[model samples]
Target: MWAVSAKRESPPVPEPLAPLIDAHTHLDACGAETAADVTAIVDRAAAVGVQAVVTIADDLDAARWAARAADWDPRVYAAVALHPTRADALDDAAKAELEVLAARPRVVAVGETGMDMYWPGKLADCADPAVQREAFAWHIDLAKRVGKPLMIHNRDADDEVLDVLAAEGAPESVIFHCFSSDAAMARTCAANGWMVSLSGTVSFRNAHALREAAAVVPAELLLVETDAPFLTPHPFRGAPNESYCLPYTVRALADLLDRPAAELAEITTTNALRTYGIG
Candidate 1:
């Protein structure tokens, strides 16, 4: 049996990198419960060179609040969607409202949507496979209708995710946020021109396969994110993560790919800009 330590405080932040952009995060989930919290969180992130973030929604209320948070800070943007596990919650009312939110000015993508088998058997909150597929399809169409990038969240259901994307024809831009699969899938996604966003999990001691994927990923297709308040990087694995803590993940990924941290910072920042369609 193995035991990872309980959460702890994060280590001191590394020296600033060139400006970075977080492709996916949940500032509200990270305890940023108010608009004021948004400013504070972005302030922490900016100090470490994270100039912007796309705070993603996992539920209907989150979608509503995510847009508001983006409006609260210039450095913030929003991605609105019903997360895969919450697919059942995508009732008609939710869909109608999400459409409105997705078309909002600072809402840059439709995402964190896809399949998840990990929570199916044991979790009461798990959405049915049929329902998840239905919601994912709707999200795909929503992305296309809005002409924004689609961000996918896949867990133990990569095949289904790809199948749906192929069936519906993916949007012009796609971001596989927190891409957890191995090098082979990474190559496949890259070949298809999908952006792969690596998160703090890549810094884990157990993530050799992820590191390998990052290594093989072309600079043009590679991206980075904090996915903060969870999956804090290697030495800070158990700590609560925030955008300010992103540099640690970049440093660890740089080591894995045998590239300089500053170099990874710049590459990912530029990748993020293109992915989010930011000017």
Candidate 2:
């Protein structure tokens, strides 16, 4: 569940930079319900140099839509999995369906599934921690079998997530989508060869730890995303987000790392292409 407030106008699109890829986003949540909407969204992103986007599925219908969306647009790819909060919904039927979706050529990853300790106790419908852990292992195995990266969504359960990854024998590739950890965790991720995908949150004024984490992340293990319809970058924190807004965060990271924005864009785009096994 997202804590959405009064709607603010979307931020002005930033100037185009070197070609980039949005390593994670949610097109369906960004109000893309049809092929035209998908094209328009990708077009907006492309105008700002976001050449490709990997939309993520948080539930069954979303999974179906994401897989289909990837086929609908040349610039779109997808990741399929139930969000950890919805781990309870991963019934046998859902598992079978997800496995099939995971194997789809356009579905680039098995993800948005790790742990969400922040909600299990606060939200009645949130899956139990045990259930979430079980589903996480299942998704990891599915990713392994599908031979795609395992995209993780961790919230307030860093240690638990790492424990599960160790026990489950992590897939060939792992991405900490929307990585919200500290420099220590960033170092750990780099040491273990796990990719860390930073979202717009890094540009927030109060995300000092996240910024520090970003600075320490090895370029080879770094990626970028929008996590659209949420976590809009600073100066537009309350506004709706879309893949097109990724440049703001990219520019912010460039300033933080004191590198040229185009260089960072190239680095992230190359990492994303390799991580998703797509062009």
Candidate 3:
């Protein structure tokens, strides 16, 4: 594990001038089930320059909530899909609901959907390589049909994920959410014109590989996220994360890319907007 400089308590609220987009987040997981919760979260995010957020809902109920939230709040966008880990639990009805969700105006992408083999128990139920491949292929085709980018969530199953992506011919604007891949994978994704969305994990001192990968990716294909309510950046590693704390990860990315924090902010915000097809 790597450590970051000790966290000083956040200073007075910074001016909301920087243009930023948290391309991937779980606003629903931020405990926002009511209008008040939604207002509070969006207010906090807006106060810190998060002009927009693409919130993902991995299940049917959450997907409904996310779509409703997006409809209610202009700043929120939604991505609806069945996560690969939950593939075994998805039935025809769930797929039908996802298809319906995909057509909604504010639902911009197809996922936080992809492969994950991080936990043995979860994988046991979804472990069949064929099942994972089919699920990934289905999502890829859905994105193509809907003309939306696919937001990928990859864990220890990189090779298989990449293989499926290649075989299925992923959409041009795929976003590898919370991307923590190595330079080789980064280069491959870059070569294929996929966007890499960095999260708080990149701030860890031990994450030299992730930093190097971040540096090598083209600025046009780079993005930043908090993966909020999870993976809080170093120094605040143990704290629950929110959109307001995003600058900490942005600052870390600035260091990694050897660019001014503001410049990195501009570049990443632009990249995220393009990737998510937001204004």
Candidate 4:
């Protein structure tokens, strides 16, 4: 099992909402390391009407785990890719293996991949911006080849992400998972037929910009996630987020976007199924 803090406590249950899908998450990072752990987590998520979750892989080991988790539970699907922060490690061997995993059954998408400038030089193991760009291009190609949606992760590199997608031509379906950019960029995504997936960050009191971004995104182009074990929604911001806490984020989006929670839930679920082609 991955090392985790002893004090890591899961979030309390919230009232169930209409069924929805968590477009992006990391089951391993959330401390669910075994088949039973996976089932328990999914069970918790089910309690809150989170019918399905697309757990993402940030590295090869995690990719392997993600693929297994998908097989272990029908509600789980995998999106495998070398995260931009770790893009420097994608050598020939890594690429070959990732290509094989990307095509695995239940490995429905190629991503949690894109440009991130927040970590390089600042954190150990973080890839340089140039390396990240190169990997992003490759991942875009892999997504296209696999005939799956490209789930992107952008952090402090919004313009660059769009540029890469435009230059190489984005996949048939592109999802900006955990979209945290401004209204202008959100509009740009909508115009280009890309998806804008909101996370708990949109509900943060200081995240007014994200709220505005959500406001401008057309309903059909919208999605939601916890980006769990990280961006827990308000009132539970500092807690260990599981898919069970997703209701908070969904409710926040419904209120911010001026739609009823149930209605928004059905819409987002439909979009998720359509976006990822999940059964």
Candidate 5:
């Protein structure tokens, strides 16, 4: 199952590694609409040793659906937050409801929040730096109040993201989801004891700097995710992604760090469980 067509189907499942967890994914964006769809997605992932996943919400509707999906499948956990690009939507009512969602038992973290300077000027509706920062700070506080890890979504605003955390005081547990920065940033995150979750983009041949960053990440602080329905790993880049494809990134990461695949699997799975407060 390691090889797959470039068509719209799920990328072929790679060889099963030791049990692993996808710390982030978008089940809804992957076209899952019901409990059965969630089962099918998780089942495919389980077949490849990705025994669990944290499906993240990027908006209100997705937040509701993510909580429901977590109930629908034991392997599914949820992290709810409005994306930084959509920070302007976090009005009073949204915040109230999001707080309730953030308190759910199966909701693992407050996340996919932080900065996205990549879109502000390029997209007219994208949240500017100030709006995104405000929303990020709010989510940070929410994570602290909820006593869960803060999951971050940083895009082309590394220094700004770090600056905001320093200014507002970060939560005890912080994770940089889809870490795309360089070795320096990786060292900084490691030094601060923040978790660094890498995605499929690390497998791209041209991602030399990302590979270097991966190499420097301490095993304990290292986590892995698919960020599926996007950032499919190399050889499968541009193909539709799903949780089952996570092993490809795990193997790629193992190669990048020159560790055994199973060892990397154990390290990342252990880190994921602790970071998300899951078993």
Candidate 6:
């Protein structure tokens, strides 16, 4: 019989890369299937060039954990709100709790919240057009009140999302995280002065449209993120993603923009800082 060692294994260490920001991430969900796994996941993110991450919460409990994590780790920033897929879960108590969390210094944005009908689950019935509109309005107002930019997540509902933003009036600095839309949508977003954050999907071979979209987006309006522990880039698509793997995604974006990876990194880093109001 083989004997197992008593020592615990350390998390995977990430290789150093040029400084970058994960404009959108769920640090609270990174290996956070249990309480003991949260800290290690964040530590791994910091080990890489993910200088700062806007950690989003889908509910009050996740928001509370995100707030605590941000307070403990200088590199972690919090974004408190109900994700669109979980829009029905946002009870009055949750909204009240988020209002308080939003005031915390480490809370930078109010999202990972928007519309998604492609694979709507529990929210299929509750997160209808009306619910999404209401939630979007509330979150937009919260962002304005707190003086933070809005981070959005739009999947298969771009028209509705754009219409809502235009109608309700979002802040000047709105970020479309993991923007996997077409060139026309990209052009519209750029024209409206919104930032489009690219993710691993941009690297997929079948994402030519996304690549075309990236190519035309102005440098000042482009940002990159791993959406880690979810949209892992190619060459490691099947593996669990982390911020350290951002270089692969960045490289792909660079190729799309016809610029050197270093230059693209600098441009996107600056854009992210500007969009998120980070120093």
Which is the leading candidate under lDDT? Answer: 2
Q: For residues 154-241, could you state the per-residue lDDT of candidate 6 as single tens digits?
A: 8888898988898889886788989988999999988998889999889898888888898889889988887766777765555666
Q: Per-residue lDDT for 70-90 in model 1, tens only?
A: 888889999999999989899
Off by over 4 Å in 5: 1-9
lDDT of 5 at 182: 96
Report clashes for each candidate as comma-separated counts.
Answer: 0, 0, 0, 0, 0, 0
TM per prediction: 0.96, 0.98, 0.91, 0.96, 0.96, 0.88
Number of the candidate with higher TM-score, 1 or 5 = 5
Candidate 4 yields a Cα-based lDDT of 0.89
- State the lDDT of candidate 5 residue by residue for 1-279, as single tens digits: 123235755667688886899999999988899999999999999999998999999888899899889999899999999999999999999999999999999999998899997887788888888999999999999999999999999888999999999999999999999999999999999999999999999999999999999999999999999987889998878888999999899889888778899999999999999888898
The worst-scoring run of ten residues by lDDT in candidate 5 lies at 1-10
Highest TM-score: give the candidate number.
Answer: 2
TM match of model 1 to true structure? 0.96
Error of 1 at 12 (Å): 2.7
Q: What are the runs in model 2 whose C-alpha is more than 4 Å off?
A: none
Whole-model Cα lDDT per candidate?
A: 0.87, 0.93, 0.80, 0.89, 0.91, 0.76
Query: Candidate 3 clashing pairs?
Result: none
After TM-score superposition, the amount by which residue 113's alpha carbon in candidate 1 deviates from its true location, in angstroms, is 0.1
lDDT of prediction 5: 0.91
TM-score ranking from best candidate downward: 2, 5, 4, 1, 3, 6
C-alpha RMSD for every candidate? 2.3, 0.8, 3.5, 2.1, 2.9, 5.5
lDDT of 2 by residue, 118-182 (tens): 99879989999999999999999999999999999999999999999999999989999999999
lDDT of 2 at 201: 90
